[model samples]
Target: MNPRTVLVLGASGLIGRFVTDDLRARGFRVVGAARSLAPAQTMSALDIELPILALDTAALKRFLGKHSVDIVVNCLGVLQDGPGSSTGAVHRDFVARLLQAVADSGRAVRLVHISIPGTADADRTAFATTKREAERLIAASGVPYAILRPGFVVAPSAYGGSAMLRALAACPLDLPETEMATPFQPVAVEDISATIAWLAARHIGDASVKAVAWDLMQLEPVTMAGVIKQFRHALGTAGWPLAAIPSFMLDLGAKIGDLASTLGWASPMRSTAIAELRRGVRGDPSAWIAATGIAPKTPAEGIGRHPATIQDKWFARLFLVKALIFASLVAFWIVSGFIALFVSYRAAAGILIAHDFPPAPVDPITIGTSLMDISIGLLIVFRRTAAVGLVAGIVASLGYMVGAAILTPDLWVEPLGALVKTGPAIVLMLVALLMLDNR
Candidate 1:
């Protein structure tokens, strides 16, 4: 076992989770840190949940000193600036503070920063520019560091853009012709962890391993279409006929994704994601291969290592359906409320009147319930309160069902079957609640 301890920031992320587990398996004393230690968010119970981006230099230094950290793996990143994320704060400012903390800690701590591929000139969005700025800061900081740029990381567990790819492949859909032809090199998550483990094995004072930046990816040439084909083959959908989706539909999806982001949903179909997808993944991994003597696994080898199981198929199929489910639930509640409140107030109030409710209390009860329905819909629109909204919707639906059964049981026998239909809606809300956790 390695006596030196390592700290992994963003330990709950797609890459960080794998890296942390890999290092621990390799006998390194690993401390995994993330913004949330909640069981639903974190991969393991051992992870230290802390607001890493919010910490200043002094606080970070103190944290490093307390843990006796020998190596720091920074996997923290954001796709775009939205409600709770800023590219500048996460990619640039945090790096600056982290570098300062390493220097002030006065420990021989080696920093392993996870970054993206492509040169600064091609950096179009804040995500790309801020990442480039962080790379420059690390190089200039004089800290013993290694900036690793991984291309199209293909992990066993998918999230964000990777998950999007899986969903597309399962549905047997391809991007536009131009996008399909764009270059997209891929690397396995295992290779990334292996490289980090290799670096950790060397002494920090070893000059050859320190202060290096390398692009990590397979040498094979691959396009976006080629990558999707690999996934299709893995998922047993290669023979399925693919429908060529128009570019405008993609643009509209991105716009919808941007709106979802403002509501605290970290959707992968946002504008920045589309722009980067257009740019495609590009990098040179020859230097990395020669330096570490680690042969990166190609997409085929990586995906083939574990055949797609029933669980994998279920996840891929449900990925997009989850969004649709939430959308329908939101619309269901809101529209129902709107019709009762504005379009059919007389029809809604008359039901209560027919049940022998007092004229004064009837209107108040109808208005209050209608507003509550709208509030539930609004709550479900935001990611943070989605679970609460789903639960409230379910409870409200049940309340209406019971109230109808008691006051107007004949309504259940009505040809429209409105009360019976509420049962399915409640079930849908339960499903939404179950699928609410992003991690």
Candidate 2:
């Protein structure tokens, strides 16, 4: 008999990647689809780059028929609404269309949706409300469905909130006392995969698991502070004294994150994320554990299973610093232009005039270069155009260096070393470009 073929949407995500790999290893022919594929994912022939969200019901039906998929696992989700993301579109509309496509395809396809754990009253943010709506849609769609709500997913690869937690653990910092005390029950990624595998092993139209909604997480009570301390121990920084971060500072960071989101950056520290974090992760896992007979690992057991390598330490330390690096680069470019164009326009133009150049074009050249500098800074401020801006900044810096060497070679020996410092600035821009990818 041939193995069952499974299709995984959003296969490049943190949980989706692991689930795809795990299912394939267990003998299922897994087809992984994502909006964009990373360099590492290019090697997998089973992984296809696809914009599933944009597809209509008819198109999706064609896709399902083409793959002959027996099961569909939707791991696609966004932390909050941003420039390129819409919670309502992804969580509600997409699921509605998918349900229609599955029914229209005339295939016995089972949908295993990933959702959040919370009641209607706890749904303060759009992220939670939309997710809950998706679950409701799935239950009523007349399709074989299972909704698994995993709490505070802690996987080997970190992104968004998990990345933030690691950064906090690596540094000598902690959240405010009240925030730390919030309930934060965590679930291992392995347990999530195991539950899916168990469900797949059963017959497709099995009555036991039809239209089931289960919360997948450890039964032991854990708090945010406990989780962070476990991470600190894994990183060998448990003894480090942690300075409490002010609550106001967290709110300020969320506002800045919201601003960043408008520029196409999907920052995890947005107001929605803050509101959800404060609400805390709470759920009962007895039903899931009883059905699957799979025991979830506690925070200590999961985090301690593997020792932290140098790469782990480096990622944790650099997570928060990535924001600082971009902010500084933006400021550097804008301020340099502002100073030259407004503060000391005469001084800027005097260099060209003093270099024995024709007086006719000196002022225009000075003004054009200053405006170009400011333009690059503005481009870098938006996530969509950041790469173009960084590359342009590098080229412009080189042009200035070469032009100065030919025109005013004496400036290299100036007391401030202004001309000599352009080299480091160029290197910094290159660093920013390399670190731009969030996933």
Can you write out model 2's per-residue Cα lDDT over 315-366, one digit (the tens) per residue? 9998898889888988988999999999999999998888888998998898
Instruction: Please identify model 1 stretches exceeding 4 Å from their true place.
Output: 38-46
Every candidate's CA RMSD: 1.3, 1.2
Candidate 1 per-residue lDDT, tens place, 21-94, comes to: 88889888889999975475454555788989999999999999998999999999999998778999999999
Clashing pairs in 1: none
How many backbone clashes are present in model 2?
0
- Cα lDDT of all candidates, in order? 0.91, 0.91
Per candidate, the number of residue pairs that clash is 0, 0
Quote the positional error of residue 115 for candidate 2 in Å. Answer: 0.1
